[model samples]
Target: MKLSHKLYPFQNSDPTRKSLGDIIILHGLFGSSKNWVTVARFLSNFGSVYTVDQRNHGDSPHSEEHSIRLMSEDLEEFIFDHKIQNPVLLGHSMGGLVAMYFDLTHPGILKKLIIQDIAPRSYPFAYDKEIQSMSFALDGFTSRTEIDSEMAKYVTDSFIRQFLQMSLDRNEDGTYRWKLNVDGLNHARRVFDDVFTFEKTSETPTLFLLGGESEYIRDSDFGVMDHFFKNNHKIKIAGGGHYIHFTHQTEYLEILNQELSFHS
Candidate 1:
């Protein structure tokens, strides 16, 4: 229940009006609500937008337990506490998996769902080397520059390194640390080996935005996807990678508005 969030409200000239349904935007693993600043700003023109930091990420309290089921249940609690009625759930990667689980388990709560760059199938992940590199880069860091220098040795992409650095938090004592719960995350990753299965269908309208340059979703995966989703739209953003919302914001938003029909 230590989830931190930011609420972006739509601009109303009339000063006495409210928008339509609320939008709950969930970020991927090692991500926070800050990543969706642009998306939330744009979406706020249509409705109230709430961007949350999932457990073990951002400002959310670190937890020893992390999984799709746990995160989804946390989401349900957030919905109940906030008293948001049938809000749209928009998530990317790990967040997307959480959204799928939440919608399926709590049948009548979701208004619409937008999952970006993730499928319902089990994704092949090999994180040992990356985790090692991360530990090495994060250890004994006095400044962000020091961490950047260390991370540069392993992560070649400048953008990705910078993005990863966002998860780093500096202590009042000038020491740096990661906001992610690496131990819990490793456990959650192992659980994903036996990902959730959809034995039944639901009518919740869902839109899946795919990264054309990413291989997360395969043609074969759509069979099981179609079986579970009764009303859904699958879109591919050309030249976009895993973080399509950041890599290709303009096109991503355009497709989102068109597919989800969120317009002001």
Candidate 2:
């Protein structure tokens, strides 16, 4: 049940005031706790915020397997270890799939749920091309520009290339390494693809946000999604892509604040 976590408590003027609800952020595959700092920091003003490094990512211990069930258990253990009560579960992409599983299995643990850019169904499209691209660039590159040049050939978007590049680290021997557990992740591709599926539905208030330009969620997944999240509202961010939170932080933040207030 032990987790390598970095916790940041939101400071309030009145120390004696009762504990308000907190936010627990889950990052997508290949993403670490650092990915949610911007959103978490902004939400901290309302209450405590936590960003978790999922197993096999970030400073969190690496594991040979990265199943959704194991991930939910890790999250459950994390909440118990931190003694966080009824915290809001916020997740993006792969993280969103984890949140859905958690809410189904541990309904009482959350006050509300926010899922960004994913649905409760399997997306088996081949991402091996992207994985291959990452593998090629993970080796030693003399300069950042060299890395960008290689990534640009596969990633298409400049912003996403930059975001992915942030996870690159240079070793003492000058070889560039990725913070993500590449071998473990690439091996668990099928499991990752099969992570999301509808289970027991909960009455918890659910909020879904999507990037208008992304094909991750659409009319096809809407029927299944509506089944579980009966009291749900999906908001689409115009002029945004898959990582809408990053691309439209201000708009996303405003919408998030409004959603939190609605739940309160």
| Predicted model with the maximum lDDT | 2
- For model 2, which pairs clash? none
| Residue ranges of candidate 1 with Cα displaced over 4 Å | 12-18, 137-140, 260-264
Q: What tens-digit string does per-residue lDDT give for candidate 1 at 42-95?
A: 888668899999998888998888877888888988888889998888989989
Model 1 — which ten-residue stretch has the worst lDDT? 124-133
Q: Residue by residue across 143-243, what tens digits does model 2's lDDT show?
A: 77898788777778786677776677778888787777777888887765656454688777888889888878778877877887777778899977778
Error of 1 at 239 (Å): 1.4
Residue 78's C-alpha lDDT in candidate 2?
A: 93
